[model samples]
Target: MKHKVILVVLDGLNDGVARHAMGHLQAYAAAGRAALYTLTCELPALSRPLYECILTGVAPIDSGIVHNNVSRLSHQRSVFHYAREAGLSTAAAAYHWVSELYNRSPFVISRDRHTEAPDFPIQYGHFYWNDHYPDSHLFADAEHLRVKHSPDFLLVHPMNIDDAGHKHGLDSAQYRNSARSADILLADYLQGWLDAGYQVLVTADHGMNNDRSHNGLLEEERQVPLFVLGDAFSFNPDVEPRQTELCGTVCALLGVAHDKPVCRDLLRPAV
Candidate 1:
């Protein structure tokens, strides 16, 4: 049977610092079912550029997304395009910008609400202008989309931790608490996906600096945590991975073709 995947992007989730802040994520790593890697993202370490890199396996310079404020993406082929060509259902429960990127592909069900809402379902797919929303509501919307649409490829981008980082600084207790909260929410949904036999990729687009800001060349802002779990990831744990490889990894697991040479299948049998 073909495998399905859920790619969860915990924005600004770091490695060494995150383990100290996110207890649930640390516990999940300790369980031995997941392979943890410190992957390096594109330069400037901003969300939009890093996200474009992950989706297209293209560097920021070539993708022309060095700035985060860019409202539209270039017409480059992304993972969504490849998945659609392979006849797979896709869904994204993320920021409003994500929906704007693809302009709502018929094969993709994108639910995004930039602002906080009294309830989540009410704002599905509508532009919400603001970029802040409760993580609880975001998770609920993701779960609802997963159950209702049952998309083969699901992307969940949670931004509260990043918000906390920017608001309270990376070292503040509020930031740690936000990371922990996101870990708990992820753990809940991860188990559901595992029970249903779906491969999972938990990672971050970028990390935050001590000053709680990003979009710089600092290692603290570039090195993000990557956790690959599920039966499909039953391979040696000693291998190092790069953020660019994830597009191919997801395509491989979902049985699709990816033309980008920058990405390699980390799960391929050891040569």
Candidate 2:
């Protein structure tokens, strides 16, 4: 049976904040819908580098995306490319930078007004600069495209928690509030996917420190929360996985081929 996969990336979603501030996430874990894992992200723990690692299954040093200012992936082989090669429709709803990475893919729904796909009728959501829109809009746009296009792979990046963490320290009440809000939105998305029988994978690009800044080598900055909600993943809750492994895991779940020899399938043999 072919399974549709939805990977939701809550940017800067850390274990500490999810355990304390996010009640919905805790409930999901308790109900067996979530398999919690501490995923060690790439060095520097920056968003772009971690994202490149997650998508390409390569290290930051090798991918050459150690900083946010760097544009585009040095390597061309990514989950998106693999999915497309397998004849599976791919769609991504993320920030402007993410859209830039998958520029003109016709499946990138982002806040950038300039990116367009004249061939497709999909109305990609666009938000203004300096004024952020709610994550619900992005999710809704993804859902619309999913229902209409029946995309085999869908990637959603929600930035509320990350933004809040950046503006206010991780210890601040504002950060907690943003986490709770993100948790609520995530719950809704998870329920829809579960009801539709789609494989759901939730993870973060990186984590934040107490000061709310990342791009460091601290444990707190490197450790991210990964929640897999599907029978395909029989992960051991105690076993922490590297973020790079996710690319292969997603490929295996979707029955797509990947070229990452170092990436092992975490779901095989029931751990």
Clashes of 2: 0
lDDT tens digits by residue: candidate 1, 1-271: 3689888888887676666766665666688767677898888689888888887777788888777777674567776777777777777778766665655422222333432222221123323234467888788878877787677787888888888888877777877788888887887787888888788888899988778799888887888888878777754567677777777778778888777643333464421
**Local distance difference test values of all predictions, in order:** 0.72, 0.71
lDDT of candidate 2 vs native?
0.71
Steric overlap count per candidate: 0, 0
Instruction: List TM-scores for all candidates, in order.
Output: 0.87, 0.87
RMSD of each: 5.1, 3.6
- CA RMSD (A), model 2: 3.6
Q: Compare the candidates by lDDT and give the number of the best one.
A: 1
Clashing pairs in 1: none
